[model samples]
Target: MISSNKLIAAISLAVVGGFVAEFAKPQMPEGSNPGYMTLISAAVGLCVGWRIMGPRAGRDSSIGLGMLGVVSLVFWGLAVFGTIEMLRLAMRRRFDEPVEALEMIVTIALKYGQYLAATPVYITLAVGIVISGYVTNFAYRRWG
Candidate 1:
């Protein structure tokens, strides 16, 4: 069922994703083309906010919900991008073994994480998620 809380959560996280993507863009290796990175991250954020954080919005403390949102966003974002990179590499026959290809997904994600950690992306995400959780909680209380 649709709810104001879910909608708010989705929108907030989507913005957070876009911000993080923009922040991370400059940190990417030189000569990398990050076409649609912001859009993809926002979409991922919308889905995760709706599916994961939305339902739990009112049930948990705002802080707890915010932390959950941040964790979910980071995990899904990394997983999606990592898998995409892995697939690109696989198509180029960069991995001789299937297992190595699968491993590359994690390796790529960790590398991405390193870049994110080195920047202000984490701070932006944390602040955004926390505010999102608060707003979602308020919506739940006001509308439900």
Candidate 2:
């Protein structure tokens, strides 16, 4: 079931994820170590691209799919990294209750969203998504 569209979308989103991680690094709070952030983001991107965006490439307008992909990527990335942060905080005894810890995941994700909104990360993501969508569509038309 492998296809050129899927491969291109995965790789394209992976690159977008790395760029977003790098762009967000400087905006992070001081002394925060973003260990493996880029790698993790890229992995998330690959999964989202292949699973979410790949199959829908040629089924709709490329621009529409690209917009959806950008939204999906950002949403998944925030959820994944926010949960990681919440877990890290929980391990450090930052939360007094399990429910509080769960709530903090959303809080942390919103905070991350604030950081993204304050930077050019969205622009990069949008552009990357659009280009990837078009490219994937092209591959589909050419190879399938």
Candidate 3:
């Protein structure tokens, strides 16, 4: 079984990696097909998660790791985009269009969910998190 602390650490790394990737993604050239950032993020996610899991995982734990990766990606996306939305809303204070912070955050989060679901690059990266977990487990067992 994956220890709770290790699992949390793995998820934390993935979420932080995702945040970094999202921040840099915007500055990338339009024609650039995501470049190495995706690979780096995946590698970091895989290595850290595998390392923290401590060299062995059962079938159930392996699956759980992948699921955790997915869950963390959702969190990462929410955090990155939600921050942007919060800032955008926070800056605008139109007298006629009063907005509640809670409501705006919720609305923005929903929109971000939909946007991420439809975005191909973002989807690929999210899926990469799952693959990274599985591959990391395999690599660590065979070679490490």
Candidate 4:
């Protein structure tokens, strides 16, 4: 059993987490879309949450599900985008200067400070999902 307030808070945190990922994109590389990574991260969170919460529960569980869904989508999207970017960088054939590629990667990494900085937020989103589920469960059993 979950409570309405806990459910709402969970959903809100998940959505805000997704939005935060989007907002952090300007700090990413030029012509790179970080929406995918954010989506993926969110999705991962949601799936984990859903698995933990299970189905056939009350309306509060539904809220948890909703939050999980959104967050999972964001997480998956972000991961896909990140992987593609890495692949593109890896595929560069300018092998004439191996060090150049490595240097380029380092430079790119430095430029995307937001991407690095946002790791904590992404981690938090996942943690939040789990926390929300537990909180909802607690509320469902104890609050009412």
82-102, model 2: which lDDT tens digit per residue?
999999998899988899999
**Tens digit per residue, CA lDDT, model 1, 46-129:** 998899988887899988887888789989999999999999999999999999999999999998887687448868977986
lDDT of 2: 0.86
Candidate lDDT (C-alpha), each: 0.88, 0.86, 0.53, 0.51
Where is model 2 more than 4 Å wrong at Cα? none
Model 3: which residue pairs collide? Answer: none
Best-performing candidate as measured by lDDT: 1
lDDT score, candidate 1:
0.88
| Candidates in descending TM-score order | 1, 2, 3, 4
Distance from true position, residue 100, model 4, in Å? 18
Best by TM-score: 1
Task: Report the error of model 3 at residue 134, Å.
Answer: 1.5
Worst 10 residues of 3 by lDDT: 52-61
Q: Which residue runs of candidate 1 sit more than 4 Å off their true CA positions?
A: none
